[model samples]
Target: MPLEEIQHWTWVFGRAQQMMLDYSLREIEKARTNDPETPMSGFAAAGGAMLKAQTDFWSDSLKLWQRFLMPEEAPSEARALSEEIGRRADRDKRFSAPAWRDSPLFDLVRQSYLLVSDHLLKGVDAIDGLDARQKERIRFATRGFVDAMSPSNFPLSNPVVIEKTLETRGENLLKGLDHLLSDLGRGQLTHTDSGAFEVGRNVAVTPGKVIKRTPLYELIHYQPTTPQLMRTPLVIFPPWINRYYILDLNPEKSFIRWAVSQGLSVFIVSWKSADAGMKDVTWDDYILRGQIDAIDTVRDLLGVDAVHAIGYCVAGTTLAATLALLAARGEADKVRSATFFTAQVDFADAGELTLFVDDDQLSVIDALANDGFLDGRYMAATFNLLRSRDLIWNYVQNNYLLGQDYAPFDLLYWNGDTTNLPALWHRSYLTDLYRDNKLVQPGALSVDGTPIDLSLVKTPAYIQAGREDHIAPLQSVWKLTEHFAGPMRFLLAGSGHIAGVVNPPTSGKYQYWSHEGTAATLSEFLEKAVETKGSWWPDWIRWIEALDDTRVAARAARMPGKGRLKALEDAPGSYVRAR
Candidate 1:
């Protein structure tokens, strides 16, 4: 039933109860045929107990009402005494039987309580499916209840529950409110789509700065405007979970814009969000058809022999996957150096996310994708649950209690932009990358018949990881240095995942640690690298420039730019436009 209708019916029942005894119950009983005794025996028993207790309370309430209305006692004092009598009356055993339980007066009130409780419980079940963390608190709150008993689960949402309970009526309403509030919170905070990409305005870019390919999969585009013109260009690959533009949030916080002014070319892959058509799009599509193709396009079109390839989060992994595949195919000769920012080539040490990788969870996700895709909302819920306290509680307070509309923050705004993943692709990815941890181990896996071995990645590489990254722990990113056969430099950036990768020197947001010699582990490297102020952008540009020899300018595209590329529907690029 619609919530409003339920509330309306509950309210009507409450008013009717005031007029007579057992009105709704008697009505509900009439709806049944053969003994309403057998099926409703349990409900009848409960109703009988409640009715009896209610009658006793009314008896006392009648006695107290005379005193409460008398001129003797103050109004406030009388009101308090009456409320106390009602409380004691509800719990008294005298009302536990059918004879006195037939008070029509309290039936509507009882119906209201039962109806709301039912609605809230239904909402809680919905929440349980989305957030794993709330399972424990759900269990804790519903403990000892038979029909509404809690499910066994780990306590991820406890902190959220504790905070909510403290904000409302003390213990009296904590259990009921917790279930309802958590449901509202989880529903609001979750999303499953990849990131959103916003292209710089046409005037902002130098004519012909925007570059792309035939199928338009591999793109090396420039956002034109630069604050400090750097000598070399850097390409960034963002995670598939979100769109690529997160690194280049907007004009001010844009790492791309910052890098351009610092004299560096900024090219980013705005990956197309996955859909039913992309169900068959394997990791090879992202590597061979995606990153590798972009590398060739950037290398040939820009007329530069070498440019910097930087990967952020999952994009880092995809970049590494492509690199490893390229190396194994004896194809590393096509490009220049590589950089990974909070990217994991090794998944064994990837932190707390492992708790979610069990077979049961995987199976559940597989079932969800039975129709060939995973819903964006489901994915969003899973990630939000990862940090339930922040995402869940903030929404609960804002949406339910405060009844406020969610204000748009770019990060969250982009986050709410959700996308679907083909079931087959999602299944294969989880099996090979997450559950098996195959890619990190040499020859343990093959991507489209090509054995992926990290040892073959002979290109000069620079890897940056955040000191406080929980998603792709620094230690996990540091693990990449060990398997690479080429010259590698590991830089530890001060901020978490997003901030670390988008670290523009002009932003002054974070410091980066650089070490001279390759270290076996992140801790060892952190113990040795020199501490420096400013963002990692400048450091990276200097490193790439050293690899980039000065070159003559390439011919700019003809006026109106020879239509070497078909417009994949206009502006925000294909990926951003996908969702």
Candidate 2:
């Protein structure tokens, strides 16, 4: 249902309840007047009953509140607050609720906010009789409500905004207004200053050439930087929801360039940003016309029977499906090995993203996509809501309230560079994978006249999941091992979706966990895991080397037109730069 309609009905229900209470009070008075011969004790008893009901309601609320303040078992929020206090004493103010230290009143406000949030979360857990979908909706709605009510959202309540305003003599407020007006004109929220970065010049600046082009995507073969090359080539399939430049953000962080330097020929599939003309493109088109086509191009260019493949996010899921189709066709040998990064083929426990997906929500989305495609802004908004405090409200407070401009952050820059989804493909994905969860069932999904059964894929697999990923939970991604009939290796990385994947060995930032053997459950895997410092890239490199036994002599890098595929354009191709 529409939020406005829900609000309207809630108002009507409240008024009806108030009217019933007033009618009951009026009846009590009339009964007392009509029964004067009888005692006034009956009227007193009735009044006491009403008072007792009100008391019971508050008594339950108090008990719920007490759970938040339990000394023996402090909630996660309480522990977080204590840690924040220590950090604040050391002059760290990176956290959102800086006003908590301004005054006891502000501190009380923070406590009340946390207490209510904790209670609402617990209340959802305590709820019974509701189906999984209903409970998910309740939890999601409650989180949204709590996020909106945070103290930092209001100017008067947030000390950082107040401090900035006073420091700038209210000039900050004027700039903030300008920022708001600019974003409104654009019809989207600005996560980063768009003017600070450009696509081909500084962002996706790696030296490469577009070797092939199709209606759905572009195939870019990066120039090799190593002295010798592995016999097997590598092809990457990035998620179509965002630009492929995320993997090749810049020189310092470009995974594509790193792969090339590691003596491996790299090829990436850059999906076109869908529009009205491409609305008819289906999931089969993405698999056959996009991924499978790119695989064929790479195999012909390298003159190899098979090539190593890597997939990230949604692309990873599609790659798995495509492999299944290949297996059914007795052509599974086309891919030497498969690696999946933060992707879920089994959507049984897809985490919070599933909360906004159901028959009703899909219908609403279908109506919006009647124009041929779901606008990129809508997709971006949905993702921002998943991390509203970090992605939405933080930007709101910074750009609107504090009047601060966003600095040039590569990840946020890539985030703002959104892409639209074709109507048919988007609808099919939500209906089949998310709602119906058809990918796990044999013959449930078909592509290019072939039935897909993931177990038929006998190629060795390497799967990595982010421990803190909100979109594809570790538990969900780990389930991929159960479906594959080949040898499998699973790695659990630290941080959320983007950070976890982009982590480099030089950064020494996040740690990853590895186990010798697969366990029965995700928890069991974690129980027997060993922590390793630095990035998982080196580990992956070693694994890839083990898969390929042939090490060839040093050779000069292949040019774009040198291959039979022929060059279409320069690197970072046209599709990625299309709006």
Candidate 3:
């Protein structure tokens, strides 16, 4: 065999060897299911399950027809199948179409698909030889298959698609074809209309000035809304994986706007999207160069000893390391208070996002980044696949099947916007954090030669997590409390990662739960937690106020073009506009 072919088969065989090491053959035999009806119960017994699935499918189809022929009679064999379909449709938006229930042929399509999907997942669960991580990867792969085969994704199978075609006299298909071609040109599935929003013009319009610029980041000092300003300035360290505009997206939904209005000076780190030039940047460089550089600039420009800090998503992960770095350097007081938005410090239960880090997939990704940067499209696709039904297929059905244009949504626009990761940083992030699970360990990792110890971080922290967050599970975010030495406040918010963090008071959307003190587990905290009616922003600002409410007369000192650091341009600086 050729050398490359031998290597490929070796990697494939390596997975089988892993199962042997992870579990004993005796355990696998003991745990193996004997249930004949359990489709594909175990790999060893797959022959029986395959025969059963084929016979069952035929048997169920016959029963469905019998039930249709005889109306008011005894209970039908397909009654359980009918009930399952109804239950799935109740919670899932995809099968909620009226035609699905009212029409027989369409209903049959939906029912058959659900039956197979359910069994496929169940079969994955029944498999005995694999570990939890291995099983999860199987389930994820199975779900992709199920989601792709969904009746709603195809024009012929979907009732809505047929209706649109007939109503538009086949014009919908023509439009759909055009949309498909356009999306192909863009090289991504568009969740929102292209050119829907522009930074500094409409979306990131909360008035601010670019006070400082480094190779890694641009610091924006937001124009304060109140006549009197709080003593401590607020700096937001958004993840370099995305543009910083998510926090500053439009005046209404912008968290930056709401914070500025509450008499606080806000500074944001606008990360330069990685290109070939940034191939050598590492995690430590991100901490010291991007985050730390932004922090020190805010201090130097505002003349404050300490500043309030906020980190979202991956930045939150980096922020935890930055705090530990600061503590090791005896400069913990540089940040007066810390707030984390849907960030994960502990990768122990990092949710479905870990699938990319498994099954020797990291090596493939490393090779792809041979140009010094991993294309942001790879990361975007991973996130979209997490909720493929909504993010991927929803667009496929709407744009290619039913022929509809994307709506102008700021959040969706931001979600579609991609940013590249430096190859070294990407590799370190996977091996060090996701693979070795080292960030939570004190001194297991180092930044600029200093060992990191999270237990030494004495700064008060407000950690907010989304109950529905898939990328960073609530349980995973909760683990950060165990690592921090500071008094921590954990707030559970409604919605997923982005909506939960960007929720504003004026919107009057979504609720939050806050507990007075820490608990042994998240469940324990929820037992005594108080559930509020609106956004968590107001409650959060009050927490900041309690820390230091000292106010000083507002000065008209924020001219963008004139400062010590000096404004290179405006708020959403050129760095964010890169690629």
Local distance difference test, each candidate: 0.59, 0.80, 0.81
lDDT of 1: 0.59
Point out the higher-scoring one by lDDT: 2 or 3: 3
Residues 225-340, model 3: lDDT tens digits: 78889989899999888888898888889899889889888888888888888888999888998888888877877678999999999999999999999999999999999999
| Clash totals, every prediction | 33, 0, 1
| Candidate no. 3 TM-score | 0.89
Return the TM-score for each candidate structure. Answer: 0.63, 0.85, 0.89
Winner by TM-score between candidate 3 and candidate 1: 3
Candidate structures ordered by lDDT, highest first: 3, 2, 1
Return the top candidate by TM-score.
3
In Å, residue 482's CA in model 3 sits off its true spot by 0.7
Q: Order candidates by TM-score, high to low.
A: 3, 2, 1
Worst ten in a row by lDDT for model 3:
65-74
Q: Which ranges in model 1 have alpha carbons more than 4 Å from their true place? A: 1-220, 223-233, 554-570
Clashing pairs in 2: none
Residue 137 CA displacement from its true place in model 3, Å:
0.6
